[model samples]
Target: MTIIKFLTLTLGATAFLSAQSSPIRSCGKPLHPKTIVQNDAPSGTVSKENKIQVALLLDTSNSMDGLIDQAKSRLWNIVNTLTTLKYNGKAPQVEIALYEYGNDGLQDENFIRQVTPLTQDLDLVSEKLFALKTNGGSEYCGAVIRDASMNLNWDGNEKSMKLIYIAGNEPFDQGRINYKETISKAKSKNIYTNTIFCGDRSEGIQSFWQSGATIGDGKYFNIDSDKKVIYIETPYDVKISEYNSKLNDTYVYYGSRGSEYKNKQMVQDKNAEVQSASSSVERTVAKSRKNAYKNDHWDLVDRAEKDADFISKVKESELPADLKGKSKEEIKKAVAEKSAQRGQIQKEIEVLSKKRQGYIDTEMKKRGNPEADDLGKAIENSVLELAKKKGYSI
Candidate 1:
């Protein structure tokens, strides 16, 4: 059986950053300079599990607003697609880092900013994407790629798929840093660097975009940045949307950022709805994916269920008002109830989402074969292919 079919068959059975400080002398030992460190995993217990790390470097010059919009609209779809991937029967963790280059408003002289470091919190990634603004500035492909490679803590696991997808319309050699050296460094670190040019395919080839991709054994593509993404509304969209709303009710927020994070969840929901009903439905489907939706930090139920000592460690003041004054057994029972409800809702969404995907797949086939050029399709195709190479069944 093909790897893709193996992954689909398994699903059919189951149904479902850092900082530093000044050094000081202590106990006759000299302290070293405060060095900033970056971690690939989010804080908590570090697992030696395999993962897929993607760094997205976008050119945010005035003309690239369409690219940013596409990223915002397609982020959830990308996450949903990755959830289908598995290695040795275990789903790999997914983390994404975001960078914006070619924006004059950025304080860095190079006009590049690390918008968000590698993180598992997908909500934070969406928040930063929505906050991005475009301005005229230098487009330094090499410089941004070098900075991300050196600064972010990429995984040392040779089996893991680590990648950089840098998209822009500028010439590949526009910056002071040598493109060859930068890409070579990325290759040495086992990071595959894919380049996406926002223009004609021939123009991208002439501009060295294809060469840049070749330097790191990556794929290159040209996309029409201004092309609108078409999301079709399936018959199951309404029920799925309703189920999503009910699923949100299963979350019980706690901790200091509980209220704020809860509000952000609703805000993202609105953001997707404003784009299109189809986009919102896509997000609902993503939330149903086993690996795509996670809220352990601020959601009391998830936190408690994930960590054995989480409930005991949480301060009384940090608990949500509804959970306050409740006994330990009562809180545990309540959280368990919410968790069970969440699982049932997610299963329902998953059943409907499979139908939705089949419909979309049939529609695309009817539309005839078309080359993948847009940001979403390009990344999705590249990721799936590369992941398969790394022994992931997609």
Candidate 2:
């Protein structure tokens, strides 16, 4: 071939190749690889450093004051820990929801409340917990899970994960709301239902709650292991150690979220610290990243609204006719299919993220803070390089 002709051919090929690439946001650097990008589809780090909607269904049964207080006290640490995750340049996206069940009984049959929808506002969750009170009954764990499944505006979590934390003294199986059906719904959406069994000596409690967790693709923890302020007077230590072990075992502790909630924290102090963290240059990046997550989540909601509208005949056909009230295991068939659509959408979001990042960079430059720029860039560069070394090519 003539040299000129060959050069022309090569240039054309390159342009085509570039066009085929996932469009990256031209705004900022691709988060230096080390930082996580919001909306990275599953990248196997949903629990590690990405967005997750965590629902805390506490058991405020007459027998469980201890667990409620412990949950309240632990909120800040949990938030601090989650914020440390850098999934795709974004802090772990978090929206913690709350519910109370097993506290009401067959007379009223069931009572459920969504104290908070999925939200990044940790303080709101804490405030809601403060109002929690012990109610009636031996436990109706199923009701809470069902409520969360039926109510909360769950994030699609195709880009993240949805976790249901159920703490109660009763066996999960014995309730009007079937635990099996709840588990099914969770599985279909990749929603995990981790259990925190609080009561004692109930027959088959282990099988009921543990099995629920198993089928739901989640874990179960002995609430007794988690130190409860109410339980300290009873001689048993809150097994925060055991709790940490589960996170470690599952690799959920990657960003030091486990450590942040290690001890009692005064509300004022926790809030102050969070505020300070918010203002730090490093934190500013994290905040921006968090906002990126919100944008992406809404993007998915919009897509789902458009694609199936989540209600198209095609979408409805994909759902099991008897899909209603299915347990987590039974719901798996549907979740698997939806995953493909999510994967495609996620790639698009990643490209857009890169472009958006460039805009952020431009503003940083406009600030004209040389040392600050150097520090941010240096930090970002190291993170991205390390991520690439780790095989992400970020």
Candidate 3:
């Protein structure tokens, strides 16, 4: 071919490859982008610097349905607690990894499955957690812990808080992998391994659960997994829920499967609502915090905020139908409006959430605050203590 023709073909191929790799895609496309423009998936260093990494290893054996229920109800509460921590007076990035064990998964794999790798996508985390099922199988505490430690992209910063919480009723030393050695390896990497026994406290000690915590230099707690979680209703909850609805309206989604992911967000809201009024309210409050519930990967408003040139570079075909023919200036203006509106909604939710929390605290004090140790409380308490030790302020 002639030099000009060869150059034309090469440039055309380059453009095609760029479009395929770009997270920005045409609407109604089936290829859902995992990140933003230029594949904005958080790199380990960009996302994990001063990050709080939490890995939850829960046993999903047949008899542990109650434990799963508690986890579902309190996932938002745990997230809210983590959002309270501040490193250097700014919110630290939070990433959570989830794993299920003792579920009759695959025997060769030791009945373990890494549900989701550590991710900042809180909606995906909730989706995976709600989908978890239970079945009888071997509970290998050591193996799960080892898998989480080795597989997750944990933050290496000494100031970042790294934690592993394993909750189960089985003996801690039941796995082929040595619990003591695995926990020691985790500690060597500055990761604290917390053990939450689902049965009686003394039984947990007798079963070597306490030893696991001691070796890893973390907290040990035993909870009644079968007990129901009590939620306190406050007058502020209603107003907060109303604000949450408005907040949801401000998200502007683009790219492939954007609409599906948007629907998934609403479904998760319903899931929390189905759990209880308090859970729904807690989730709404968590969503108000940008540091806790980020959707920059798909939401145009968030992406615009993070990348100043995103609105300018986005192609007309990549935009939603309503925005397809709009000018770049018009699109930017629309995103700016949604962002401001969201900020107002979030502020309203935050004010009401604080009042709601205060009311709950007062009621608990009046009731003498019954000691009801459950999965969420176990993780929340331990996280607060450990975060403080890492010099993070609440």
lDDT of 1 by residue, 1-394 (tens): 0001111111110001111111211112111101112222311222336666778889999999888888877777776766666666565666777888998887776788887776666667777788888898889888888888777767777877788888999898887988889999888988889888998899899989999999978889888888887676688989999997898899899877788888888888888788777778877876665454567878877677679678767777888888899887788888889989988888788778789878877876788635564687787667766765676664
RMSD of each: 9.1, 22.9, 13.3
Score residue 285 of candidate 2 by CA lDDT: 23
Better by lDDT, candidate 3 or 2? 3
Among all candidates shown, the one with the greatest lDDT: 3
**lDDT score of model 2?**
0.42
The lDDT for every candidate, in the order shown, is 0.71, 0.42, 0.72
Q: After superposition, how far is residue 258 of candidate 2 from its true place, in Å?
A: 33
lDDT of 3 by residue, 92-118 (tens): 677777788888854445778777766
* Descending-lDDT candidate ranking: 3, 1, 2
- Model 2 scores a TM of 0.47
Off by over 4 Å in 2: 1-50, 105-108, 199-207, 225-394
TM, every model: 0.87, 0.47, 0.87
**Pairs clashing in candidate 1?**
none
lDDT of 2 at 128: 61
